[model samples]
Target: MKHTIKATWMRGGTSKCWVFERSELDVPGFTTDEVLLRLFGSPDPRQIDGVGGGSSTTSKAVILGPSDEPGIDVEYTFAQVGIDQAVVDWGSNCGNCSAVIAPYALKRGWVEPEDGILTVRIRNTNTGQILIERMNLDGSEAEAFIPGVPFPGQAVDIGFLDPAGATTGALFPDGKELSTLSVEDEDPRTRSDITATLIDAGAPVVIIDAQTAGLGTADFRQWPTACTAEMPRLERIRRAGAVAMGLAKTEEDAQRAIPKLAIVAPAESGSDADIKVMMLSMGAPHPALAITGSVALTLGAHHPGTLIAQQLASAPDGELRLQTPAGLITTWQRQIDGQLAVGTSRTARELADATLSFDPAGERTENPAVILAQGTGLDEQQLEPDPPPHGRRTVFASVAAFAVLGLGATLVGGGLLNPPATTADGDYAGETLEVVIPLAEGGGTDTWARFVGQELVHDIPGEPGFAPINDAGGEGITGSNRFASSAADDGTELLVSTATTVVPWVLDRHVVKYSFEDLEPVLVNGTGGVIYARTAAGVKSTRDLIDRKKPLVFGGISATGLDLTTLVAFDLLEADITATFGFEGRGPVNLALQRGEVDIDYSTTSSYHSAVEPIAKEGSATVLMSFGQLDEHGEVVRDPNFPDAPTVVEVYKDLHGKEPSGPKLEAYKTLLGLTYTYQKGLWAPKDAPEEAVDLLRDSAHELSGDEEFNKKAAEVLGGYPIVADENLSQRVKDAYTVTDETKGYVTALLKDSYGIELD
Candidate 1:
C-alpha cells in the first residue's frame, strides 16, 4: 500500500523544508519518520527515488500543528531527514527552517494578518523554544535581502523567547561560561587545546576563538575553502564540547546534530561587520552560519566575558554584525517578557505544493547506529531536548545526513527493483521501471529524465517502482550505446534521448550503435532557442554577415552535439563566423561571449530568461532569431513563447530578399527537426512485450496531459512541450529518418568547416 502526504516545499533562511500540517502526517500504521525517510529516498546519496535534493538543507521536513499552549499559535517538529543515510536527527532545533513558519501559517490561513503585518508564535517542539516571527505581509520581493542569497524575498523577524535555557535550563550549560577543550589527535602525545564558551541558548552551542585552532583574524578576510580542511580538529572540538556542555557523557557518544560549534574572530577594521564567524555542521565548514547557531553566537558576543564578546572590539549600538563566508548577517538582542531573547531576519519562499506518496515496504537498509529522533517512531525519542539527570545532553552514537538548507541551490528528486511484468495489463506491483539516462547525474538531461520518468510511473499500471541509472560518459554516447546494446528488452527498461546523443546519430557517427529507428518512441519533448550575438562584436543584424570586416566568433560545446543545430543555422544564413569548439556547455559559451572571447551564442528557451534577457536588456547582446517550432508541414514558425523574435527562415528572407533554398537549408531543417523539435524523448526496445509497450505509452500520454504534472515540470521542461499527440509517433519517426543527402551534407560540412572526421 502507498501512503501519500500533502506538502509545501519552502525555503526558510538558508534551509529548505517540506512543510506539513501535523494532522496530515499523524496517520495510523505508519510513523512520520518512516514516511519522510521513504518520501525523501534516504539510504541513497542522490535521493533520486524520492523528492530529496540529495543534500542536507534540501532534505529537511517541518511538521506544524495548532498549539494549545497559551499565546502560542503553532507547535512544530523539525525533522532533519537523511539524504544518504537511514537516520532522521531531531536532537536540536533549526533556526534557518524556522524562518518558514509564519509565512506558511499565513498562506495556509493558520494565522491571520493584521493590517498588512503578520505576527505569530511558533514553538519548536524539539527544544521547547517559542519563536515569535513578525512578517510584513506587504513585504515585496524587492524589499528583502540577506547574505548568501543572490535574490531578495519577504524579510521576516524571528525572535527566540527566553532562549538562554531552552536546551539545558541554563545560559552556560557547564556552569562556567569560559572553558578550555583539549582535543587530542590520534597520537595522544599530540594534543590541541582550545578556549571555548559552552552555552545552551538558541540550540546549545560551543563558541571558540579562531586563533585557538591556528586561525587568526587575517583568515577572516577572503578566506577560501574556509576550514574545510580542519575536519579532524572540528570533529574533535564538536565531540569534546558536547561532553563539556554535559550534553553527552563522552566524546564517543556525542550526537551529530546538537551542541553546535563555531569559530569567531574580529572582522577587519572599517569592515561593515563587527566580528566574523565560521561554523562547522556535521563536521563540515558551513557555507553560512546556522540560523540557530547565529542566535547563540550573538548572545555570547553580547554577554560580558565570552570568547565571542572579547573578539568584538566594541558592542554594536543595536544589532550585532556578523561577517560570514556568504556575506554579512545582522542580528539583534532584546528583553522579551523580562527574558533574554535574540533574533535575526530571513526571507522565505515556497518552491512547490504537491502530494507525495511513499511506499513503506519498498526497502530499508538497516544501520544499527541510526537513532530515532521522534516520540512515536520507536516508542521513545532517543535524542530528546530533555537534558539527562547529569544536567547535560544524553549521549547517542550515530551518523546521520546533515542536509543544510543553503541558498544558491535551484532545488529541482529513486526506484524499486523488481521483476518485469510480461503484459501491458500486468500489474507492476513488484516491478521496477529502470530508466537509462546516458548523461551524468545532476545535469539538465538527468534532471528532466528523473522528473518525468519518476512521476510518470505513478500513473502506470500498478504504479511500478522507479530506478534511474546514469551511465554518463562519452558525452552521453557511452550510456546510449550501453543501454541500446544491453538494457532489458522488456517494458521494464526505457532509454532517455537528448540532443547530445541525437546529433551524433544524425551525422552517422561511428560511435552511435543504437538506432532510434529500431526503438519505439513512447514520448517526446520539443524545445525552442535563439541565436544571439554580442553587440560588442560590431554586428547589428543578419545583414552584417556578408560585408563584415571581421568574422564573428562563436563558442560551443561540440560540433557533434547540440551545437550542430546552430552550426547548420550559421551555414544556412551564410554567416561570416569563426567557430570555436570545446568550451564545456552552453553556460560556459554564454560566459565566454560575455567576456568577449566569443562574439555570438545561443540560449534555449528555459535558460533564455536567466541567461539571455539580462544581457540583451543590458545592451550587450541581440536576439537575432529563434530556432522556432516545426509546424505540421515541416515549416518553421515563431515560438509562442518567443513570438517577438523572428524565425531563422524569416531572417534569411529579410536579409537576402527571398527564401533561400539549397543543401545547407535542407541540412539545417533536418538537424532542427532532430535536435530541437524532437530534442528529448523516451523509447522502449522493439522486442519489448506489445502489451507492456502499449500500456507504457498510454500512461506517458496520460501523464503528458496531466495538468498537475505539466505545472510541476514547467521549469525542468525549459518551456518545452511534451509531445504526446496521436501523430507524435509518426512525427518522431519522420524526423528520425535522416535522408542520405541531408546526412552527407551535414557530415561533409563538419569535416570541411570544422576539420572533424566521422568515427
Candidate 2:
C-alpha cells in the first residue's frame, strides 16, 4: 500500500529538519521508522535518491500530534534517521530540530498566539519531556540569528520544563554526577579510562575532560578539524556511558543514540565562552551544538558536582555560553511561574508544506527492515555500529565533519593542522608558508586566513608549502605573541592580523610584545558594522542610551578586541550601559538581546542584513548608527554602505548638541580606523628580505585586481577593498601608530571603568 502524507521542511535552529503529523504515518503494514528511512534514502552517505541533506543535523525528522498528556499543547517525537545505515534512532532528543514545532503548530493552526506572543507547550514522546516554546506573533519580520545560520528566521525561545531525567528517570543517570568509562577496546594503541558526567537532563549526555582524552589542554583550544581516530574511542565510550546510565544491557547492545559524548575543556583566556566543546552527534562531530546539549550544559554549568561545572571558565553566575565549532551559543536558566526553567533561543523557518506518497515497506536491506514494524522496543543489538578496521571512522552526517579526505595534510604539535599547498617556482619553492592565524578554526578570521593563504600560495612566484596554523588562545593574543617572538624573518612566516590581535598592541598591554611598527605589511583589508540596541531595554531612541534610570546591559567579547572600539563609543556618548565583557562573539550578543539577556549589541556588515535587519524592521531593535569609516584625511566619515545610519560621532553631536573634542572621541576615532577601516592584514618580520616581501606584495596587488579572485572574495571582504599597492605600508603605518593620548584613555577606561588591570 502507498502512504501519502503532508510534511514540512524547516530550518529549525542550527539545522533543517523535516516535520510531519503523527496521523500521516499511521499506514498499515509499516512502522514509522521504515517509512522515514526509505523517504530519506539512508544506507548511503550520498543519499542520491532522497531529499535528505545527508547529515545528522539535516537528516532529522520530528513527528507532531495532538497532546494526550495533561496541560500539554502537542505531542512529538524526535527521530535521527541514520546516514549510511538502515536504521532510525529514536533513542534520544534533538534540541535544534525541536525548534520547528511551535512555528509549525501556528502554521498548521494547531496553536494560537496569546497576547501577541505565540507560545506552545510541546511534549516529546520519546523522552516524555515538555518544552514551552515562544516567539513574537505580533509581527512577521523579527528574526533570531543563532550564529552562522545562512538566513534569519523566527527566533523560537525553548524552555525545557523541569528538564531533568528525561531519558533514564534521574538527573544523574548513573546515580552520581561522575562516571568512569573504560575505552580499552576502542583505542588501537592505548587503554585509557575516561571520566564522564552522565546527566539525564534534556538528553543523557556524557561530558568528558579534553585533557583526559590524551589531546592535552593546548590542542583542545584550537578546536582541531580532524579527530577521526578519536571518534571510534568516543563511540565506545558512549556505549559504556549508556550501559552505566542503565540505558542499555551491554556495550554492544547500546543503541546508536543517547548518552551523547562531548569533549569539554576550560575556555581559553579572555574567551567569551564559559566552556569549549567538541560535540559529537551520532558518531560525527556536531556541526553546531545540539539544542538538547545546550539545555543540559546550562543546568550542569551551575552544579558544582557536574563535569561541566569543573570545566567552566566563569563563576557560573549568569547564563552558560558554549564555544562550539560553529561559534558561541548561549543558554540560560530562570524562575518562571516559581519553577526553575532552562532555555535558549533557536531560529526557525518553515521550508515546505507538502504531501508525498511512499511505499509502506522500505527498500530491502541485508538486515531485515521489518524489525521496525513490530510494536516492541528497538532491537538493541541490531543497532550496534560496524567497527571500522584499525578503529577508523568517517561521518555521513556533515559536510564539515572531520573525515580527513585523502589530502596529505600533517597535524603537528601545538594544534596546528598543516595542509601544505603544492610547491611551485620562486625563491622559496622548497619553503613552507606558515600563516599564524590567531583565532579558532571555523571562525571568520580563520576562514579568511586559510582562503587567502591557499590562494596566495597558488599564484606566488614560488608556490611554497601552505601551513595555516590556528593558535586560538587568550582571545587571539597568544598566537600573535608566538608569531611575534619566533616567526622566521625570511618572509616564509606571515602573521594574520585582525582587530583581536591589533587592539592589545594599540592599548600597549604588557603582554603585547610585538609592535605593528616592527612588521612589514603585505596586504590589508577593511570591514565595517553598525551599532544597534533592543527596544525592549528602555531604548526607544538613541537619546535613551544615556542618563536612563537603568543602564542597558551590553554584551561583548573582550575589552581589548574589536569590542574595545565599541566600549570607547559607550564612553564617548556617556551611554548608560553595564558592559558584560565575555560573550563568545557579536552573534551571541545579538541572541542575548533577543532573549533579553542583554540590550545593546552590534553586527558585522556582512551579517547585518541576515542577522539584524529583520529585527530592526520589526521594531524589536533600532539600527542607523555606524562606527563610521576612515576617510583620506584620517577623519571619521559615515560608512558608505550604511549611508542612512548616522556616524557614532554624529550621533554624539545629535545627543550633546555639538561636536565634542576629548580623548574619548579621539580614542573612539583611533579604534574605528584600526579595528574597522584598516582592520585585517598580513605582516612579515621587518627584517625579512625586501625582495621576498616585494614579490609577495606584487602578487597580492595582482590578486586584489583579479576579477575572479575579487568576485569570489566579495563576501569575505565584506564590501571592503584589499589594499596591496605601494602606498599600503605607509597607510598601514599611519593607522597602526596609536597616539599616546588615545592609548592612555583606553588603558584608563579598562582599569577604571571595567575594573580590568591589564598586564
lDDT accuracy of residue 159 in candidate 2:
92
Summarize candidate 2's per-residue lDDT along 1-759 as a digit string, tens digits.
556777888888776788888887776656676678667776444455666776556888899887766778888998887655556767567787888888888887988888888878888877777788888877763586667674688888889998888678888876777777776664357766778888877777888888665445334423432344344466788888889999999888886657787788888899888888877765555656777877788887778888888887556766888888767888889876676778888888888777766654445432232332233333433343433211212122111112212223455785437534332224555456778877755567876777777778766765564656555555676567667777878888899999988887877665566788889999988889998999978787788988789998889877778888888998898888888865667777888889899999987787888889999999999884889899999789988788898999898999999996888887887888888998889998999888889888988898888888888887777768788999998888887777888888888898898887655
- Predictions in order: lDDT: 0.75, 0.75
- Compute each candidate's TM-score over C-alphas: 0.52, 0.51
| Model 1: per-residue Cα lDDT over 1-759, one tens digit each | 666789999988767789998777765766666667677877465687888886566888898877888999989988887543455678667788888888888887888988888889888888777898888766453158676554566788999887786767888987886888888785868987778999877777888777765466334532322243344566788889998888889998998777888888877899988998887665445656777888888878777788888888897666998987767889898876686668989988888999988664463333322333222245226434322211222221111211110112232323323333345556555456778877755567877788888778888877765656665555677667767767787788899999989887777765477788878888998788988999988867777766688989989877788998898888888888888875646887787788899999999877899999999999999889999888889888898889898988888898889997888787878888888888889999988887787788788888888889888888888667687666767888888887889888888888898876665
lDDT of 1 at 653: 91
- Residue-pair clashes per prediction, in order, are 16, 3
Highest TM-score: which candidate?
1
Winning candidate number (lDDT): 1
Q: Per-residue lDDT for 35 in model 1? A: 67
* Cα deviation of 384, candidate 1, in Å: 12
How high is the lDDT of residue 479 in model 2?
A: 63
